[model samples]
Target: MSKTVTVSDQTGTEALAAQLAAVAKPGDVILMHGTLGMGKSAFCRAFIRAVANNPHEEVPSPTFTLVQIYELDRLPVWHFDLYRLSDPEEIHELDIEDAFADAVSLIEWPDRLEYLTPENRLDIHIEPGSNPDGRVFILEPSGDDWIKRIDQLSRDQA
Candidate 1:
């Protein structure tokens, strides 16, 4: 299933991230796809902060570092940026298989991974909206489980 959410400002974007974080847990994978400046990093930062329960935590983009690991009270999170990767095989060096085993993974530019990504995952596509500071998020679930979770998210927000 799929759903779209419009975020008007940075705060709204963060709120959306926190809401998503509430339903996410270890062993979950969230793939984010968007062009540069589409707020993918911002959404990730907010989600990481929420999961860590530290609103002031310093969450940096993994563009250069490749992957950033955060140990939240609930579960560990592995945030990955594959934009700089020249080959998908490079992911093996990072031991991503281990992280995906029992961690919440937020991946940006996941196209590089292609079919390597698990069958069941949440794919979030971000795009520019009509408002100057607005962002439109298109969420596509990979399985029935995610569809139910998305519905719960909507009900929670309501």
Candidate 2:
């Protein structure tokens, strides 16, 4: 099952990200799905900032860098962008296994992960909504950890 959330603007996206960040813990993996300009980076920026409890922190996209690691007070955050990756095997160089075991990971262009994708994860598909700034999030949570949180979030949104 999936839950859909509609956000009117960037602020709405940030608010949603904040909610997730508050509940996120080590070993949590969030797989982001969307096309170019769909605000995946924007959502991640907000999520990392909220998790770090810093509103002014610089959250840059890992597009060229491939991955960005942030050592926050709680735990590390590994943000991965696999758009430029030509092969999934290249992920080995990023030491993603460590992030999988100990940190909270947010991935963009996760399709590149292929067989390496974790079994327990929350997959969020972003699509354009009614307005220019609006976005519709279709959340598919696979693990118990995510199902419970997403269920609560559904009720909260209701």
Candidate 3:
């Protein structure tokens, strides 16, 4: 299933992330796609903060680092930025298979790892709108569980 949300500001984005955090489970894979300055990193920051239950926690983009692992409320959250990757095979060296087995993975610039990403992942496309600070979030669920969750989220927000 698919749904779209309009986030007016960073606060709204954080709120949305918090809501998602409340329901997200281990083994969840979120693939985020967007251009530079499209708030992809901002959303990741909010998500990690909410999951960790520590708003003060630092959530930096792992563009150069490839992946950053965060211990959130004792649960592992793996944030991966594949923007700098030259090939998806390079991900093998990061031991991502084991990470995927246990943690919730959030990937930025997931297109670079399309072949490696799971088939049941959640795909999110963030787009810049006509107005500054406005963003259009397109969410597509790749599996039955996420599809149901997306539908529920849509109804709850509506």
Candidate topping TM-score? 2
lDDT string, candidate 2, 57-124, tens digits: 99988999999999999778999999999899999999999999999999999999999999999999
- Candidate 1 vs 2: which has more TM-score: 2
For model 1, the run of ten residues with the poorest summed lDDT: 149-158
Local distance difference test, each candidate: 0.87, 0.91, 0.83
Question: Per-residue alpha-carbon lDDT of model 1 for 1-158, expressed as tens digits?
Answer: 68888877788789889988999978889999999999999999999999989999999889999999998888899999999987889999887897888898999999988668888899999988777778888889887878888877653221
Could you tell me the C-alpha RMSD of candidate 2 in Å? 1.4
Query: What lDDT score goes with residue 101 in model 3?
Result: 87
* Model 2 misplaced stretches (Cα beyond 4 Å): 154-158
Tell me the number of clashing residue pairs for each predicted model. 0, 0, 0
